[model samples]
Target: MKQINSIEDNLEILEPFISGLNKYLEKSRSLSLFKKLPIRDDKENINDRLLEGSYLFSPCGVELRESECNSLALELIDLLKLHLTDRADEINTISDHLLNEKINPHSIILSTIKNEGNEIRKKIRQLNLPEDLFTFFLIYLARPFREQAASYLLEKIEKLIWLYGYCPVCGHWPVLAHINEESGERTLWCVCCNTKWKFKRTQCAFCLNENHESLEIISPVNEESYRIHACKKCKRYLKEIKSNNDAMNFQFDKMYLGTVPLDMIAEKQGYIQESILTVRYDNPAGNELLMYRQKAIKEKISIN
Candidate 1:
């Protein structure tokens, strides 16, 4: 509930709880690091203009197709899954270390699994990707400013938050994730980097609604400290909770989404969420009626 400047600030305040996410949420029942992966061509032959009035942008941005992203993401997730199990803590530890110094945040992501040891890479190698395409990944990992890439990626993802209404990373809509820390309680994990962001407990992520009638509380209502917030129009939900101790669970949204049974229960109660934290993270300028989007601004000529 303490106000923080940025997502990173919230993560800092919730550090102890994030560290303990592994223990509180058993990894066994958790979704694969690649949960809800889209098939490469899931949106094939569909026109995108239908949603243009809604201020939605394709996450691929003409660089790639939805299918291509899904395929690449699947490949990448496979890599993380192959290795994330035993090395989850190590990878996270190194990620935090790099975050501390703001070093090569992406490359500094410590993977205990050797690159050569990854099965996905072996499969990719077998595919014989063109040198340029294959090398792009290597360059991405070793980019000069990884934090820039992370920021760019994160910002780009924020845009897609509206399009698909799901976390760009895990592809899983949040169920009942908890922050598990004194400060980070009821925060969400970036479906991509698995980063955590502390959002206001009662506010709606899409429309920013706090009206009691518009929002519904689903499962885990019995926990006293936590409950689900669902917006019917937005088709999204997030968990909010109270905590007194500092928690070290890094598996923030993982455990939250793992409660499939609870998700079913919520869905049955006539409450549903198709996305998480998408609109809230993206640019205020990007929405329809912004300073740049105004028709007057478009027609006006420069006085200078």
Candidate 2:
């Protein structure tokens, strides 16, 4: 585990939520839920996808047992319930559904869960459950599981690494991009499974457009060090932070939330805050990635 500088003392804006997340993450690895996750495997798995010199599982390819997923989700819900006093009943209901395999955490975060005009959305509103809050809960619960699964495959394949626009592990797009202060190289950070990969500095992660004219860089006047890399081709944006390699302990999850203001700014400029590459590529994982990516491209092309 990497050590992070304490930001708890400075937290007052979203005190309960932000501080709780920081505190929870500090000890998340030690929790029994996280410990139960499978570790580095001695034997290579048959289902691991070998892509661009890395071994990764598809979004649905994580080999976690249903029992394991339920246990992890239950524990995570219990932890979240501590901070979410107002939503205890809703949390309990969520717990029941998760335990019964009636709901999947990954699907929710990946935006693949379609409960529109369903009882679930009605329940969500009735219980005052915010979509972002629910998604956060899901991501936190699923992170350790995905991380452990990826590690198992990476251990067997010594050269396992990815340079693609999408996550090699989960096939999701990066939530943040950062530059290596020393090498000046670029890397994409995946919030889904906490994976990082080197990527082409000039290429757009979304539409894979390499035209410099189509890429616009926006920087906040207050925070000159941070940048919003927006692609004119796809109208999609990714936040970039300047950090040294030694800062591997950077709290990317926390940083991502803290930079919501930047996301808003990007969105106001006609660029999207979310990933444009949500689709699963053509693989055994089916068209999950491909469909999403194609839709994003089609929408942007039509708009322009």
Candidate 3:
């Protein structure tokens, strides 16, 4: 295996997967699917499996057996059932043969750069979930794949959205951030929409707060480069690194991947938000902006 020297290089490894994604996008963005998806409403709520998605955090480095993936898929149906009469026991059963250690629900989502290979995408469609869910599942995948998969899911669902619309994609909300890469041009990338708009990276993305007093930079006791960007105007914050060494041009998506624990601390202080991924769970993938917390997946281990 060769080391990836740049983000562009890593993204290339995903070309085969991205190529397939281009087709999924053209077929998915339909208004009919976005208007009113038929899932159990709050008052009519009766499904048990539906709750699982909200709680579904695909664990890391964990291997899921075909039995487990199928079982979870069954749970997905359970989660999908809008009516109590829906029989996952009869209509939806896990294909015991479909399990593969690679079917990482967590890894799949995170590989925003890598669209699930055809086998996984085919398996996802096999679940027969509401169209919105497929979108969420796709974008919720934080990997670069989400970048394209979310685009495909939204286009399939037929929704009109800007590149940087609010965190409408996962229907999750956003906790805002300010990123200033090299050109001194700061872009506001919504965790949900995958939209990038220009703003003063130094100013608050949420409230445009400029007072140095209103903003605070909280750093870890030991780590010098990493710090939290907190704003008093909106009472929101995000994380950033001002390093002495510029060799590492940090991409936030990849940068924040290993820093879940720090996000927890930021949220605890009420400095900024964490899961402000989107407003609704139904929003198509990649469109939802996400914080580190929403990206948290429990540690998974398949005993089998």
- Specify the highest-lDDT model's number: 2
Q: Compose the digit string of candidate 3's lDDT tens values, residues 89-152.
A: 4323322222443345444433322222343456556764333344433453342323333443
Evaluation by lDDT, superior candidate among 1 and 2: 2
Using TM-score, give the best candidate's number: 2
Show model 1 residue runs off by greater than 4 Å: 1-186, 220-226, 232-235, 240-249, 275-304
TM-score (C-alpha) between model 2 and the true structure = 0.68
Task: Give the candidate order by descending TM-score.
Answer: 2, 3, 1
Question: TM per model?
Answer: 0.36, 0.68, 0.38
lDDT score, candidate 1:
0.37
Least lDDT summed over 10 consecutive residues: which range in candidate 3? Answer: 295-304
Question: 168-266, model 2: which lDDT tens digit per residue?
Answer: 666667888887778778888877667777788878887778899989888766565577888998788888877774436766776676666667778
Candidate 1 per-residue lDDT over residues 129-242, each given as its tens digit: 333323323322321122222333344333322222223332223334455554543455443334344445665644445587878776453444445667765555665444
Candidate 3 lands at a TM-score of 0.38
Model 3 stretches with alpha carbons more than 4 Å out: 1-139, 142-146, 149-184, 191-195, 243-250, 272-274, 280-304
Clashes of each: 23, 4, 48
